[model samples]
Target: MSSSNKPHYEADPNKVDYDEGNNRWTFKPRGLSIIWGNDRRYWNLPDQSSFAVDRTLNYDMDYDQRSEALSGPHWKGDGSSISSDKACPATCRVPAKALNIIWGNDPRFWQWIKLSEVETRSVGFDEGARLLQVNWIEVTGKLPTTMFNVASTTKYEVYYVMKFQVDAFGWHSVPIKFKVRLNGQETAKNFVLESYKEKHDVWHEICGGEFTVSKNAAGVVEFGMFEVKSEWWKGSVVLAGWSEDDVSQSQQTREETSYSQPRHIEETSTEAKLGETKLKRVEKEAESKAPSGSTRESSRF
Candidate 1:
């Protein structure tokens, strides 16, 4: 037999598409990267670029289109969007002060203000244009000097700060201002508040805004009112923020990681709850006063 008549052999790996889905570009054997060509059109695709010409010619697809050809069965094509859960509703309460409400849900906790109907159009209400309305009371209670020691102690003032948070998937919130009233007297200036969050839970905090009661006022501090402006989507709810001078660094790191989760902030007490403290008379302070004429340093807890 002549040497030219003998069979021919190629020393290269062949490209095989076993799945027919355009994806699954596996070499003939599992680990082989160098694909050999036996008089085939092209050789050594190196990275994706080398295969670009062949992929375009064989499939008549552009680079982008060819790249996506095989992305179906095994992978949900690139750039796919993921849907998220709706935002949960938030509630605020003050354990010591109880406002006039239909029910006292918890006997141990005194809720001074409640703003559930912040939503517009609750059945037969007027128009849905009302920003969240606040219900406040001028209940008598001593300030937690130990817990919030950063606040002024010389002559305590009733500053009303407002903070709020909203739940929205893709919607951006607009800035808004609200009203603060003390004993039926509304302030000329509105309190400004901002939003913040940890993990999935969001909160708003309004600080340094207070109403003052004169030493000659009848009782301790009276119920002063504070309102906030907020935009709500069909799926989101707003919550309150804390009055902390410095936010924890650990909280910021958690936001970037996918493992972030919600955390609860508990009220701390240095001493046991005093039985006599419940009825203790509130001394009238002379110097402290809020822009609003009413007396009482209030916040959304």
Candidate 2:
């Protein structure tokens, strides 16, 4: 057979070139390599050939069209001419002595704050939000001592702010109720949260009532929430609290001593217990200053 008349056939389907000098057909397989973007939908065939291209594949085109649609004006009708209003300024200010705790979500914050009968789980895109889901009957935790300092004869008020949410698939006949306790005593009345019975999972913040702490109190305040009825209801809880006033002079003195001269502050008793002793002294002083009164019948004459 003549070299020019020799059969020039390519065994591999990928090759587009032929070696006429050597009378050999190059066999290179066409590869259908795909490159995917951050989103799986957005992809391209980087190593695809004309013969390997699939006419029905519209991943790249669909992704591009979707991106363009999302980039368009959020509001309809003359969006270019629409003026944006300035955001309203904050009217109230947080007090300097205010104590706030955002737990479970923030690793930098306190983790010792227990969440009984609940589990900590991440939610939202990329698991940005950490939530405590109630698995059993109730979720309970103690308030951190950093939030308040016990004082003698001076009452302290504590306030709690919590966020809650229900599972998207979960539903309940009755609203889920919250019962807040401070040192085992119910401070806030039982109430139903707005997120209860929500079809789609959404976070809702609920602020509890003020709980007064007596001067002689020692134990940590407890906070908890429970469902009204036994069901497979699940929700998340995030807590925060603050005290009514700043640390008292006695508390400041003790704190300064502990830091500056640790030997001066006794380790035998806690600061709260010591505050109770000071409260007794305060009561004695007030009693000594009061004048004695005598009931007599001479006034009637």
Candidate 3:
């Protein structure tokens, strides 16, 4: 860090706020970034892309990896990590590119959009997976239980953070299920997203389910959004991202989020079943009762 590095770089217009009334975002740079950041990258890049994404030759820009999971502190203004923004013990956030999205990379089925300045700043993700049109709708995510301390009494929640496009369709009747599984126990909640269509473009954190961390939990906590049972075609919805959050950690103000050393897990770690890859087809459950030790609750708006 230097006392006069601000002259080395310029303020990023997209990252810094631009108030029409106040004409914000025109402020002079504070200093050179100590490291890679969201607003500004290793250089003046929008975001970094993976090798696989670069070779595809179709992406507008590499998917921004900075917004998902990081091993350091998050910045407040433009990549400036304030000393006041202390770290928590641990946390996890899976963006679209980091999740096992069914046909997520395919151009015909899904479109991955690099989040705009507003989206990146507001939702805290660099990209979102938008559903172009699809019959077998499924997007999955998971995190190893070891990320959390061994405290079975700790209440945690999983949420699929997403929103709908104005022209989104084919979700009026069919219900999309949100599921969370841990320690071999699982909980499932279903919601008809059409109910919220009136509030288009708004982000809705559809809670998969809440559960206490289990001592027996070892492998990974499984969570996802699925609607594979139907033959119905669905389109025009954006899957921003998802994450496993400690209830208490999430309640803090945006400025004081206690996300400590973040670790990136395998994006496609959730192994697919025999028939899922070609096209996932979920069969109706033979048993209506939930598995042992699992709780079932109706989802409410």
Candidate 4:
């Protein structure tokens, strides 16, 4: 916070924008790159091991913990709060298999746009309920599917949106989802799912922690994210990363792991069985009344 303490740091070339036509360059620093006056530098050097990322390792250098630690004792970044650009590392050496954040979908009327109340209709149940539901979903993925240029590409690109609704004379919680895909097969291998909620009206961007996918021996792969608990109550399902070289192993495994509806057993209820029997008798009586030659006419109706 000293006016005279000059901030000393190296100028990152990637942060500098070059205009060939204008022959001018614009430098965009990650926030005000002001170094602490205490001369001690704690910069970690990037090495070859850092670049050789296997399936297990992922470098998501977001300043969440660092910023939070700095919040109490020392208000870094002028206490303006941690931002994505300032929080995430300027350069990350991630695994080739690790998927990056890509696209998301939060439909207003996913299941039912309009909120409503309905009464229970079970035989022995009598109750009324009111709940919000999502019936439909739409998603788009293009920019996040683009290739990353080592020389010219920016360190991080943001592609998140917070969709929220208003009800009960107040604003409801916002929905957040991430656009994620594999690093190499960006376009052909990508999926979408819900993101974490940071606050009442804000959803935090999906971190690199949740992104997961794995390749098998047959060159086939499996990848997906966790189910999002949105308005529908039921979780979402998304799949990406398929190849033609395998013997249907990944697909079978995915099918085996997929969510299934619970089965409903017909309990032996005498009254219900009696009702069904009576209904069948009524149908049989109605059929008997119809003339034999009128079968075709009744069927058409």
Candidate 5:
């Protein structure tokens, strides 16, 4: 296939649809995804697994969608959307467009790849954003109250759904910036990706902080994923998109919304995310911070 500088998914700017009754905007999936996130309705793997993509599929996994393309049974024709799950009503899937992936339209730094043509087994998403190479990584998006009308005096969190490729680089030395803002309040954090770089090819969620909705705040939430100051070149990460949900509800119903069936998970993604430590944190001397090269396996923030 010939390459184009523009993102393939951006062809249809009006892809997302608003669910008035639910007070949320429906997400459309187009490219490379790591996991199906917490919703089984969106992935090919069996009922239990985190980060909704092919990495979670084991020998016992029942991925019926393997028979055809993501555009079949689960995804839309153009690989632009996820099938709706009524059971998980509060969870909202946001498209990659909402995140405003920087340099997404430029083939030199980023490109969109269609997964169905290259993947042998059932993968995640229809198309994914491919980082060819970049010295500065920045992905930012804003959800206005006009689109997502959340309840007043409630808390919600934003996540950029992504995964690093096997050949991903520059993650160990530089820290990633994840931040979120609502009204005038903002929360941000720096996470060291040293432990995570080696565990490539699996999907992960980096929280861009959380925000509380209030009556006078207007309810607009902004979030981002950035690694600009380090100036180290990084490449080979596939970004699926974004997801949002009530912080309180997620803490309470994680067991229910995490998977379709029950399985024994020692430390759920919730534990990794809400439970924070140096495992994911990066200090002020981040630019020179490198992993000891010790085999550290898991990570969360």
Candidate 6:
């Protein structure tokens, strides 16, 4: 039978009956198949209660669709990329445009580094390597958590993957070391990238093991890369994950609305308290103005 036409049974947890012959549990609806035995078992039937989230940071200018051409070789000072001290002159040549030049000094070019407190520089381009030189780019900050929706008393796992490349841009033959930390904890041992080798443009992958996110708390993912001692490092970084209890987009909106309900209730409660206080004050005034206790009682009657 087609999945849509298949018979579905809603089993009562407390009333499930065990069948000795089949070594399975039978439910209310006849012909419902629910296997529970040494040979076969089914637990936690699908209810579409989970949510998945995958987010990636775009650093390469080639794929940017903005008419302003926001992505490309850019530079910045003081760790802020919003303003540029200088920008590469615009070119109409197809070959020059394809170069996708990016200066490490221009903050506008580096969109991936959200927070930095150190001075950094971007150097030459490797035509064969397709890599741009970057030095002393110390970055540390929390990844976006607005997309997370976790529930209390439930544990959720966050898996992350970051891909990039590092090299010592021919200036030195010494190896270059790169550090990456997630959620304030070191994810992997620091590794060295050999300088000026044939494989200097070698790619690297950082696989962050599943980290548990506490209930009702947004997952915090932080990326940190230390200064490259000799050569420039270039590549893209990507982070993505999903939760066991996935929240649909509409459900997330509802959750946000629910968060506002308490404040609304507080406002309504304040108005009610004010009304009560006014009523009490008016009652006191009326009592004082009444001719006497018996006269007030007679008027009321």
Query: How do these models rank on TM-score, best leading?
Result: 3, 5, 2, 6, 1, 4
lDDT of 3 by residue, 187-225 (tens): 766656665567788766656666676555566677777
Q: Supply candidate 6's per-residue lDDT for 105.
A: 28
Best model per lDDT: 3
User: In model 4, which residue pairs have backbone atoms overlapping below 3 Å?
Assistant: 102-179, 102-180, 103-179, 110-134, 110-135, 110-136, 111-134, 111-135, 111-136
lDDT of 4 by residue, 74-138 (tens): 10111122123322222221211122211121121122121112211111112111112322122
The model with the greater TM-score, 1 or 4, is 1
Residue 183 Cα positional deviation in candidate 2, in Å, after optimal superposition: 5.1
lDDT of 5 by residue, 1-301 (tens): 1123322212122434565775765433322232433232222222113222222212232333331122121111221243334113255666554346655654546767766543312223466777767765777766654344444666666666566777787766655667777666777766555455555776565555666666444556677777655546788787777766677776554454422221111224443343234323433334345334322111111
> Who is ahead in lDDT, 1 or 6?
6
TM-score of each: 0.23, 0.29, 0.54, 0.20, 0.53, 0.26
Question: How well does candidate 2 score on lDDT at residue 223?
Answer: 47
lDDT pick, better of 1 and 4: 1
RMSD of candidate 5 to the true fold?
Answer: 19.3
Runs of candidate 2 with Cα error greater than 4 angstroms are 1-137, 144-147, 150-172, 182-184, 195-204, 235-301
Per-residue lDDT, model 5, residue 95, is 55
Q: Clashes in model 2: which pairs?
A: 14-30
Stretches off by above 4 angstroms in model 4 are 1-133, 136-138, 144-149, 152-159, 163-179, 183-198, 208-301
- Candidate 5 positional error at 271, Å: 16
Residue-by-residue lDDT tens digits, candidate 6, 93-114: 0111121123432322232332
The lDDT of model 1 is 0.25
State which candidate, 4 or 6, has the greater TM-score: 6
